[model samples]
Target chain A: MPAGQAVPRGPRTSRFALRPDERRSLGFILPFVLIELALVAGPLALGFYYSFFKVEYFQLTSFRGLDNYWRVITSPMVLGSIGATAIFSIVALGLTLTVGMALAVHLERDSRWNVAVRAVALVPYVISMLVGSLLLRWIFSTDAGFMAVVLGPIGLGDHSVLANPGSAMAALVFNAVWRDSAFAMIVLLAGLKSIPPSLYDAARVDGAGAFYRFRRITLPLMRLSILIAVVRLLIHFVNVLTFSLILTGGGPNGATRTTGLALYELGFVEFKLGDANALAILVFLFNLILVAFNLLLFRERRRAP
Target chain B: MTIASSPVARPWRRRARSRSAINALINLVIAAFALAPILWGLSTSLKPTQDILVYPPQIVPERPTLEHYAMLFQTGIQTPIINSVIVSVGAVLLSLGIGAIAAYAIARLPFRGKTVLIFFIVALMSIPLPSLIVPTFTFLANVHLSNSLTGLILLYSAYQIPFVVWILYSYFLSLPIELENAALIDGYSRFQTLRKVVLPLSGPGLVASGLFVVTFAWNDFVVAVAMISSGESKTLPVAIYGYLGFYGRDWGPLTAAAIISILPVIAVFVFFQRYFLTGMTSGGTKS
Candidate 1:
């Protein structure tokens, strides 16, 4: 029977009533169910299947079994990209969290100036990654670029930041921080707003200073938000491509090539379809590990009190 | 930084003055950090080629001109711009429509496996894009849907639906269930009740998710590059990449094109600032 024919039942309905509920729910959720199967699950399955076969010029050849995965894992360039991605993620996380926390605290007030400052902070978050990368390239360019113009009078104009390997990595980290810190601030600011003012008032009445109140009250309350922001930023910084791709082309002898950039090169430039697919699976596994850790933190939070 | 200064309270007047002074300085630095690159891009776009090449670069263009921007339109930039608009609008509409129905069902309908469904949606939001691009490209190629705007629209809507459901599901949860019950009792069908009652109340949520979808569809580079090979079907971001590939260090027109690509986002963001923040923060911390 159709669901409308039966009277509405409570949560403990019998097996017959339960059938109608399932049918009605399936009708409601069918669109999303179809979408996930085709777009997400299907693609992921194909990625795994493609990794086990050797393909040359878009034609699949003999089965390679574990050879593609083995080669990808042992390659020196892939190892270097993994190392670079880790360093980039850690350093970018540090800079973004520090700067974002400072901005959130400084601009937390609802005054006219503070509101305007907060609004100004979100400008970079909406701009396309391509646009942001291009803008940063122009800013740090050695030829009549802003950095060159400022550093020229100080006798430092001869060198480009992107020309040196170390500085290029630093520039990549800085660019990541610059692009994402505002988003961090938004999340952190939301956490900050949730803390009750009475807690701070109580702390102040006990002769505690601003530092004491923040250390004693604010930090503990803001831990969950910080974790969320950190996890989100880690995922983004690890996967970032446009900054390194457009600005430095992952160049200066491959110093700034992230795993994402490396994957692009493997798939597009070298046309090693099988190896690229293997690398893509590896990257997905890496992200899955991070997210699993995040879930652990979430469960721990839920179990508290 | 200011917290360190607040401990040594002198006279009230001195304390207030110092605190405000410090706040102003901090705000100035933050604003400059955010706006300086954009302003520099704008300035570079306005300068003639000679001024851009000169040493000790001028902060403001002495004689700003529109030649670079005019040159952009005088060329074939219009095609990619139109492609971007079509994809964004198409993706936003389809994702929001499909997502709304599913979200309403999840929120209101009594269902088994609902918890699992919600978990999958959240998990999908964090799935790395590069991992999927390799397989998605081959799949599209197999079906002969590659290098087409329809292909892009389909992919964008599919990828973005998780996010749309995430935002709208929360909005639906917060709405009172009694409203829906009343509508049902008044003899309105479930679909009619959603159209007449629930959707009108979720206008802010609709605008928020719509803006987010537009931004994602417009700003994507990896998916577009991997999916689109032909210039005729490329979106704005990929077109900008093409300019870099072909023009070889041409800054003037590059900056102009960059400016053009970001204008729509800036306009939408400024207008819907509150809704954007609410949607993002709620989705971030709560979900």
Candidate 2:
């Protein structure tokens, strides 16, 4: 039907009733399903298959069962990227959660400043990561960077975050937290709000310490929210591919080389189709593992009575 | 009752006395630290090129100017604002239309494989875009859609449909069925009932889904990087990034570009933030 077409009221009125004779709805979704199957499902399956076969752009080239997998499983460069991605993700996740949780707790008190804090918390998320890194590039500049020379003057002044390996990673982690912590705070704040005030009042009357209340009550209650936040952070960290592409360009001697950047280098830049396919498969498997970790955590919560 | 009379009842008093002071101090510090970059960005956007780097950089600009903002549009390179607007608006329309229908179907109509369909959509959460890079690029190129705003809108619409569909389905599902029954007796067809009654009633969910589509399309960088290469067709994020590459150390124009680039996203977020927040939490906790 057209946007405003009037339908006959007698029989067609019941869209919810059995439309046993109708195929239109099936037609509506069929194309979408086929495209998903072809584009998304096919590629993922083919990717895994290519990992088993010696493959390049258009050729199976040859069957090298377990060979590409072996290379990926052993390459120090691949392992190193995994390590970098892990550290980047874990540190960012930890800080975002902790900071978000802290902020959420503070705002729950309903102070007037809560509005200011909440607004500030959300602003950073609106900044595009590409622009965000560009800004950070300026802020961390040794020559004219404001961050090193200004706020934390004596301690951080003179040190360039991009030049050093540990600090480089720290800079990336800091950037991720700054962008995503707002998101976490938003989600966790909702979780906090869902809990009845009566519960907190009862805890206070029972003489629960702040620590006791948070540990025994807040943490457990926020499990689903925390799980969602972690999962979201993990996926975004995987795909924050642009940062390494631009920020450091996996620089300081590959100190910041992310898995995605390496794939781009191999697949697009170098035209190393085989290596790129292998790298993509590895990242896919790693992501699957993280997703599984999240589902398991959520399921465990559900299974508890 | 004796337990309450015991020290247990006043335990919060002791804990609060010690921790309240400490908590206040620590959280203030953290909030300030977390906000430092944004504050710095705002400060720097206000500064002139020379003052931007003044050693021990001044918190307040010695002399602020709109020079950077003035310089933003002076560039010969195309701004992605138009592209961003088109793609985001197009995506919002398409996603909401398809999502509303799909959600209503799932919410009201009983069908085989309904549960499985919802599950399939939810499972998309696992497939990171990076893993889909090669296939996505290949597909777009093969179809002659790469580098086009239409293609970008389609990409976002495809990616966001599942998320928006699932949630809107639930949001619509929870509305009392009597509304539909009343519409039925009033001689409205199912389609009319949906457009006239159901859609209007789910205003908050529509805002939530539409805003999400808008932001995801607007702030996106990765797919834009993979798909678009031409200077003429780049989105704001890509345009600003490219601008930075050429205009390095030109703080005046760069800050101007950053501020302009993010204005739409910020506006959208501020306007419907509550709906977005509630939508997100509903999807997570309702399951």
Candidate 3:
């Protein structure tokens, strides 16, 4: 867009000579860069490097190719944890998005109570995972959580939700959704607010029903937001560590063990640094694939529109 | 204009009376479904453990008492509210310093791989952290960094900086550039431009990042539990985690500890008023 010829010229260092503002910029960036080099990037890169070698007392014993990756795949506990993580993620994602989107739409429609509800909705989100898990653990405890008491008339009874594998996983997902739904709602609400009001007027004039208009106009317009919500929820589900770790310790009998918990066990508890790093790299790649998949879905939706 | 809370703008409001009644019914159902857990959490926190174990249980506490709250304050479990304050404040202060400089660079300075650097900051959000815990632990182990308050601060800062940079960077980017240019024209140095003009104008971003850093570090349990083994260095979440193992599954005290942990985060939410409104809704642009 600049009035330059097609030939790519060198960066205009001569014209864009360093000014006092630029010097200030260097001063600002210097410390943060040093910290990152020493702390984050260093750990991450070395984390990968150490995985290949037998890391013992700051020394790499020897580079054992593929051994770490193989251990992650073949180890029963680790693989089981991965399977549990997958199940936990999928269940939580489905429940949160459905419930969260519904709540967002409800808030958008029920404007009278919107502020009160929105504040309450945000309560769980702001509360530390430590707190929420603790609260829910008490409320859903096998003998006397409030959920059982509330559902008692309906014969649900006061069984500890965590005692049952299905319910334990359900409880974990339940607590997570309760907290995370606010985020999904916020994203969707932003999207909903952005839609042109005229589209609703146009739909009404055409005598299209509310459901149909929502299906045709709102859903279509919400594509980007929904995609974002899904991606966010996906990231949350896979990477979530605190809730599962605190609530269940992977489970009563590994019923609720997830890949994340497995990584912690392998790396810290078992001291399998290489295996944990390999698993972590795999989780990252796995997440990358999910993100790519969501993008692909977004592109397809755009093309169809 | 402030978006008023009125049903007039909603599509459902235009329906007939009969249809409206049905719509209200559906809305109530959804609201109740969503509000159930909050109500549930409140109920159990008020109930005695013996009453808690009663199946086909009472919905409300028969004798509503502060016993659970009392239990939470019991020793071997409680994270002294002051400890939570220390870590959360430390997190906010340190992360702000680091994020401010890094954000300043990305926002103002023209360096190579600027886009790449931005991407790296954003990418930190999506990376599954479970994987990192292992390597992080091992790395921490080598440096004798494990089991220290300093280690927890360092790791939390690492996590918080990327986020702080991101929120602040966009805000800094959006501020009018002419102020910095004008300061330069007036012969004030870049440092002066930042100190006087850029930084002052970008208070909202700083406040927002401050809120985020504080909230995150306050809520964090994983790093605290992993890095620090000593009771003195152990923060609130770690203390709460220890409560479970220590008390041998006493939900009353555990729930109490959990509530105590959140008071600081709540205070933070209330304190950073303007930042809370503008900041949280500003999602990290990863999506």
Best by lDDT: 1
CA lDDT, candidate 3, residue B240: 76
A1-305 per-residue lDDT for model 1 (tens digits): 45457655556647544565577768877887797788777777877888999988668898999999999999988898888889999999999999999989988888989888888888888788889888998888886567866677988877799989998999898888888888999988878988999998888889999998888898999998888789878877787777788888887889999888898889878878889889988888888876665665555544655
For model 1, the superposed segments whose C-alpha errors exceed 4 Å read A1-18, A296-305, B1-10, B282-287
Please report, as a residue range, the 10-residue window in candidate 1 chain A with the lowest summed lDDT: A296-305
Q: In candidate 3, which residue ranges exceed 4 Å CA deviation?
A: A1-27, A55-63, A109-112, A145-147, A150-159, A290-305, B1-80, B270-274, B281-287
Deviation (Å) of B234 in candidate 3: 0.5
Ranked candidates, highest DockQ first: 1, 3, 2
What C-alpha lDDT does candidate 1 achieve relative to the native structure? 0.84
lDDT of 3 at A198: 96
What are the per-residue Cα lDDT tens digits for candidate 2 across B1-287? Answer: 36535776698667667776776676577667655655666678888877876776788777877777766766643457887788889889877887787777777765667756765666664467766675566556656787888888877777777667766887898899999989979999777888999998998788887877777787778778777888778888778777777887676677677767676677776777666665555332110
Please report how far candidate 1 places residue A9 from its true position, in Å. Answer: 8.8
Q: What shift in Å separates residue B62 of candidate 2 from its native position after superposition?
A: 2.7
Query: Pick by DockQ: which candidate is best?
Result: 1
Candidate 1: CAPRI quality band:
medium
Taking the tens digit of each residue's C-alpha lDDT, what string does model 3 give over A21-63? 4556666777766766767667777777776876555567889
Instruction: Single out the weakest 10-residue window by summed lDDT for candidate 3 chain B.
Output: B278-287
